[model samples]
Target chain A: MSQAAAAPLPPSHREPRTERGRRTHRAILDAAAHEFGTRGYHDTGITHITARAGVALGSFYTWFESKEAVFRALVADLSAQVRDHVGPHVAAAPDGLAAEEAGLAHFLAFARQQKLIYRIIDEAEFVAPDAFRAHYETTAARILTRLQAAAAKGEIRADVSEAHAWAIMGMNVFLGLRYGIWDDSAATTAVAQTANSMLRDGLKP
Target chain B: MSQAAAAPLPPSHREPRTERGRRTHRAILDAAAHEFGTRGYHDTGITHITARAGVALGSFYTWFESKEAVFRALVADLSAQVRDHVGPHVAAAPDGLAAEEAGLAHFLAFARQQKLIYRIIDEAEFVAPDAFRAHYETTAARILTRLQAAAAKGEIRADVSEAHAWAIMGMNVFLGLRYGIWDDSAATTAVAQTANSMLRDGLKP
Candidate 1:
């Protein structure tokens, strides 16, 4: 561990001014995703990230002050990545429930391709506790917003609240872990449809 | 880090034979839970565990061989603790959905009291991957069996499968994190009842 890593610093203290600087910053983050995703936080080093990014040590310092900063940034980046990847698919759905199904299906697909997303995000609970909480809080809040919109449109129950959003988010997260990360043998659409059915119609006999 | 911790040993390779021995073993595990739960795995040492347990160095070795062994055992122990804590509440419910409601309510209470549980279990993902997997796998399997039983009893849809089980487990987990670990301001029974309503009836208005 580097001495710089010991002192906590703001993750995004510096931003790229030009295209070349932006490219270098992006490369460093992408490389960080791979290294932190694979080697984990304790084992991974700034040199490992720089080596993988093919950037100079000075370039890393210019962008990120320490290992912790890059990791915190990566957590936020991955959180945004999930939102970007699934947002459009969700928006395309005709109704709120359908939007959920679509969001889950796309999330499963994203998890399969970007398997490291789970590891990176999960580790944030310890490495960057605030970021971890923010990710779920943001995701659940988004779900709540969608649910409220659906309720206003008379598409779903009028009593939709924060708890409902949390429940749905939890269901989607675990389903992604089981079908997406643990095994890809199961069809994503089929899994989504099954869960969506339960969401669409109660599990009554 | 001790050299003994480097070698992988069966978590339960040595079992206490006498009453006195069993008490000593239990004390060590309880102490380990506190140390590992608070300090985390890498930061904790054997002496830390022994001192906390009020046992001598030899007493620590009498039951477990290394730090890794105790940590693995702790994962399994915590997993069992959750099951033992929540099982009766679930079983005592009159119906399938009600059982889920009861399970969540009790689980929330358990999380609030044993706050260290989330940290220890979450850390197991990196420290003891297999044990972490086993914990969820076993919990999901139990949920599946309950769903199947409920289906047979005409309490739920006939098609309740592993997917449904995973979805419910996910809901409970995230709900626990939000309402249980993060903030206990919300009444657990209220959260469980709201979630149960969704499971009992579809989200449709």
Candidate 2:
């Protein structure tokens, strides 16, 4: 998760005042994820989102000001969703290495279910650069914290640092892309176990 | 390092038959790298590439059919460039693990010098999907070959598999983005050494 707590809608986004409004807000964001993920930022429009959301044009404006605003929000939403979905699995693990394995396995499962995730997040690089950077930065920071805590308890090496966190994040991200998004032939647990062993024992003969 | 040998220009591309033509072809590709790298595929034009290359309008057509064609070719060209540039350094290392270290170190330097590389390659995911997939698939395949060879020699664990190769590639790629593209403050060798150490000894206390 990001160092910042899960924030409510930012200033640019108008916070829904009632349960109905909140449902509308959530609907639009989910619809935006599908439209943007399928049609891409350039091809997707506010009407596309509104149409898919089954919300009135006025409702989209009630929450988001523009196509860019919604896209940015969706990126953050997806980032948070990944963290929330995988955080529990990671916390349930027996140790640091097992936590990583669980995190990766859960992530792969999430990616498989939400295939549009890769497209939307990848598109953020061009559509919203700050969100893209923040997503990775915060994700790496969270991983760093976990590794440091693990090291402190002697669960892993004492020299764990930010680079190691980034390395692990990289591993999980690519593995998710290959085994989760591209092809589902490989078993998620099997993949996670293979990667976990490498982390646990290195490659030394 | 693709399983297939570095190929001559595919049929879509007109291979220059003479030295002067070859120079023109090379110039056009380098110019495409800069133009597409900067302006991106949608914003860049054939005229822009030709203008940057300082080649005649006819010469652009002689080498490439359209902007999309050139972008596809550029992805392949950059892929080959990375393989060729990093291959020698990897080969010069004494063993499998050290070779990965050298490969990463050299890649960081290369990414620093060619900062446009990340932008172009990332954009290819949307602009030219096949080429983008080919770049990574071939790269992972090459890594798998190295790991299998190392395992056979008793330099690394015999259980090394395709998953291990993807994990390593992911590590190098993300590390390169963080230390190489995002910030230059970190020492490349130090970062590579840190990551290499994890691969060498795992994270056990």
Candidate 3:
């Protein structure tokens, strides 16, 4: 789980004033994820998002001023969604190391169900560089915090740092890509167990 | 070093047969790496590469048939360059575990010097999906081979599998991006040592 909402949306984006407005805002963002995920940012247009969203053209413009604006919001939205989905699993785990495994397993499941998440986030690298950087930086920071908490409790190594956090994040991201999005032949539970064992014992025989 | 040349140049690429031809071929690839790395594949043109290579347009045609062809070759070349640059260091290390640290330290240095490597290889994710997959698959396979060898020798955990190889690769890749490409403030050896400690001792307190 990460703090995707750490960065606030820019003032350029209009906030919803009513329940109906919020639903419309969310609908457009969901549609944007699908459109941008499938067609890519360069190929996707505002019309494509509006059409898929089943929202009026006026509504998209009501929340987002342009394609770039909505794309940025979509990245943030997806980041938050992953956090929401994975946070509980991590919280449920009994320890810091177990939390890592639980987080990864749930994340893999989420990735499988929402494969578009990868495409949208990966595309953000070129489409919205700032959001892309923020996503990873924020995610790594969260991992570092958890590691520190674990160390405080004497649950893990005492010398954990930002580097360890990034290393774990990298491991989770690639493992998710390979097993979750690319192919689902391997069991997510099994994959997580293998990785967590390494987390537990390194490579010692 | 990885044998980038192990893969045959597709018939589309006209291999150079003479010493001067080989020099010309090498120059064009180096130039393409620069152009594609800087301008990106879509923005880069054959003329841009030739101009940068200080070679005639005819010379480009003598080697690569099209921009896509050259881009494919460039991905392979970069993949090979990383392997070659990092391989000797891994070889010099006394054990499988030490080899990983050596490989990562050298890889960080290579990434710092060849920052475009990340951009080019990343862009290949979209431009040349096959090449991008091949680059990682081959690299992972190499790591898996070493891990299996180490396991056989009882130098590491007996259960080290492809998952472990991918995990280590993921760690190295993100570490390279954060420390190598993004900033040079952190010492490569220090960063590698931190990660290697995790590999050597897990996260146990």
- 2 or 3, greater by lDDT: 2
Q: Is the docking of candidate 1 incorrect, acceptable, medium or high quality?
A: medium
CA lDDT of every candidate:
0.89, 0.89, 0.88
Q: Which ten residues in a row have the lowest lDDT in candidate 2 chain B?
A: B1-10
- TM-score for candidate 3, please give it: 0.95
lDDT per residue as tens, model 2, A1-205:
2334323335567778899999999999999999999999999989999999999999899898899899888988899999999999999999998999999999999999999999999988888877888888888988999999988988999999999999999999999988998888899999999999999989999
lDDT tens digits by residue: candidate 1, A1-205? 1223323334464788999999998999999999999999999999999999999999999988889989988887888899999999999999999999999999999999999999999999999887788788878888999999999999999999999999999999999988999888899999999999999897888
The number of the candidate with the highest TM-score is 2
* Distance from true location, Cα of B192 in model 1, Å: 0.6
Where's the lowest-lDDT run of ten residues in candidate 2 chain A? Answer: A1-10
Instruction: TM-score for candidate 1, please give it.
Output: 0.93
Candidate 3's C-alpha runs over 4 A off are: A1-12, B1-11
Give one digit per residue, the lDDT tens place, for model 3 in A1-205: 2234445545557879999999999999989988998888889989999999999899888898899999988888898899999999998999999999999999889999999988788778777877887888888888999999999999999999989998999999989877887777889999999998898779877
Backbone clashes in model 2, listed as residue pairs: none
Ten-residue segment with the worst summed lDDT in candidate 1 chain A?
Answer: A1-10
Can you tell me which runs of candidate 2 are displaced by over 4 Å? A1-11, B1-10
Clashes in model 1: which pairs?
A: none
